[model samples]
Each structure stands twice: as structure tokens, then as C-alpha cells.
Target: MKQTTCRIRCVNALVLAGVIATTLAACSADPGATPTTEPTTAESTSPIDRFLTPTESVPPTAYPSATNSEQVANNVVSWYESGGEEQITGVRDRSKEIYSHHAEDNWSIDFSLFFDRSKEAQEYPPIPDRKTQAAWSTALKHVRSGASDIYMSNQLGIVRGSKEVKREAHGWKELAQGVKGLKAIEARLHREFGLDPLTSP
Candidate 1:
């Protein structure tokens, strides 16, 4: 009877241990179903779940188109006739006012005017090569002619002054003296055969 009681107790303990091991194995197997494995890893409380994230593409910005010379000339001429040149020339006239304040007095103004004149000339288109035989020969003349009204006025003044100077200064004695000097000029000097500077005044 003692041997039977001891055997029953041992059997009961072994059965209880087997049941506990089985429960632990089930908890480890299904982590979602059991709190033990679930708490081992952090919970993702995000409102929505994602697997592969979507990518976005950004487009480059484009710049504005530039105005061509023909359009620029048309616009500039229209603006000038509407009193733009008068306004610009008024500002340019005040160049003298700011000249002294600059680092290199007078130098910058001269260079600035030179640049402005060059820039203004390119504002108009060139005459087509097929236009005429004299196109190449007279291109500069047309450019000078088409320049703003103020430049044309200055060119006219220059021509008028040159004519007046030639008329007042030329004489037979002056002509003969210029010719004699041209003949006598030293070959080594490479001096040009041109008008005598003294006779001009």
C-alpha cells in the first residue's frame, strides 16, 4: 500500500510539470496570441500600417524667355518716342554729378558710357547681306543712322563742324606747304602724308 501511494504522488507531479511545459511551448509558438512574446517586442501604435513606402518626384523650375533684338528695338523705339530718351538723357547728364565721388574719377564714367553705347548698338538687328551690293560697305552708316536721336544729333553736329573747319582753313599756301612736308617726310619715321595740324587752327 505504501509503495502504491508514493507512485501516485510522483505520477501526479510529473503530469503537472508536463502540462506547464506544454503551456509555455504554445505561448512561444504563437506570439500574437500570447502576451509574453507580445510584450518582448515594442508595439507599433501608428494609425495606418505600411509595407513598402511610396516615393515622390520633384520637378525643376523653368526660367523666363529672353527678348530678341528686333523686339527690343521696337520696344525701345516706342519707349523713346514716348519720351524715354529724354528721361534717360536727363539721368545721363547727371553723370557729371557722381563723377567725383567714384574711386577713379572720370575713368569709370568714360568706360560706362562706352559700354552703354556698345550695348545700345546691339539693340538693333543687322541689315541682311542679300539686301544690296553696298550692304557691307554701308552697314556702319546705317547703324550710326539708326542710333538714338541724341546720337544722330551729335553726328550731324560733327559733320557740320568738319565742313566749317575745312572751308575756313583750306588755302593754296596751306595746300602747297602740306604737299612739300609729305614729300620731305623721312622714310624711317613712317609718318603719314596727311593734313598739317598747324594749318587747321
Candidate 2:
């Protein structure tokens, strides 16, 4: 009877161990199978995906009509004639008011070119004659040079110190010459192009 009882207890202990081992094995992940990963969210992928986004677009500005171009040309001439030259020259005073006025005037002239009329004038039919083209090119060069001179003069004038003030005075002289050169080119451009007179106010 004692031998039978001991045998029964050993069998029961073995069964219990086997059952625990099986349970552990089932709970653990399968090493032979492929590991699954969660899908990536947009926020995580946004930087890489941004290159696929469409570009934002803007509408193009239209060129000005012939009548508007003529009027703009006339206006430019009138502006220059009506003491525009004086306003720039008067920067020699170096007063805050004078500087503001000069800057405003220059900006007005520069901004005017953005109008449709100015675009039309710039896109005017090309001249066939080499001489005429050369003249036009020269005039354009002068206009650019004049604008540079005025800008440089204004910059130099803003420098603080007596020496800078003197330098500013010298810059004013150069600016004056540039203004004259541009005025001359303006006249030539108007006459040659058969547009409204740029020199006549």
C-alpha cells in the first residue's frame, strides 16, 4: 500500500510541472514568426511626405494698355519736372524732413514702374536699327546709374559724424549729375519711342 501511494504522488508532481512549462511557452512570443509593427501616423511621416505637396501659385500681373502707358509716361515726366530734381538735390541739408521727402519721391518713381503701363513701355516693340538700339541701351544705362547714385548718396548721408556729413555733401554732387543724365535719357526715350514726351511736363 505504501509503495502505491508514493508512486501516485510522484506522477502528480510531474504533471503539475509539465502544465506550468506549457503555459509559459504559450504566453511568450513566437521567435520563428515575423514581428509586427504599428502603422506610422501622418505626423511621424510629414517631413518625408512634404516633398509631395503641390506648390502654391500666384496670378501674373497683366501688362498695361497703350493709353495707360502714355499717361504713365506723361506723369513720370511731370513728376520729374515739378521740382523732383530739387527734392533730391535738397538732401544736402540732411534734415530728417528732407531725407523723408527724398526717400518717398524715389520710392514713388520706383513703384510706378510696377504698373501695367510701365510694363508695356518696357515691352515695347524692338527697334530694328542698331543705332537706335544702341542709343536706347545707353539711355537705360544712364537711368540705372542715376538711380544708383541717388541711393548711395542717401546711404552716405545717413552716417553719423562731421566727416560723414562732408562725404554726404560730395555724394549729393554725384547724385545731381546722375539726375541730369537720367533726365536727358528720359527725353530721348520719349522722342525715339514716339510715346508721350518724358521730358515735357
Q: How many residue pairs clash in each candidate?
A: 0, 1
Give the total clashing residue pairs for model 1.
0
Residue-level lDDT tens digits of model 2 in 1-201: 999999999999999999999877866755765444765675566463566435321111232333655654554334334433332223212222222435344432332232232233234433333344454444334433434444444453365567645554554454444345434444554574443432242
- The lDDT per prediction is 0.35, 0.43
Clashing pairs in 2: 64-116
The numbered model that scores best in lDDT is 2
TM-score of each: 0.20, 0.27
* CA displacement after TM-score superposition, residue 60 of candidate 1 (Å): 28
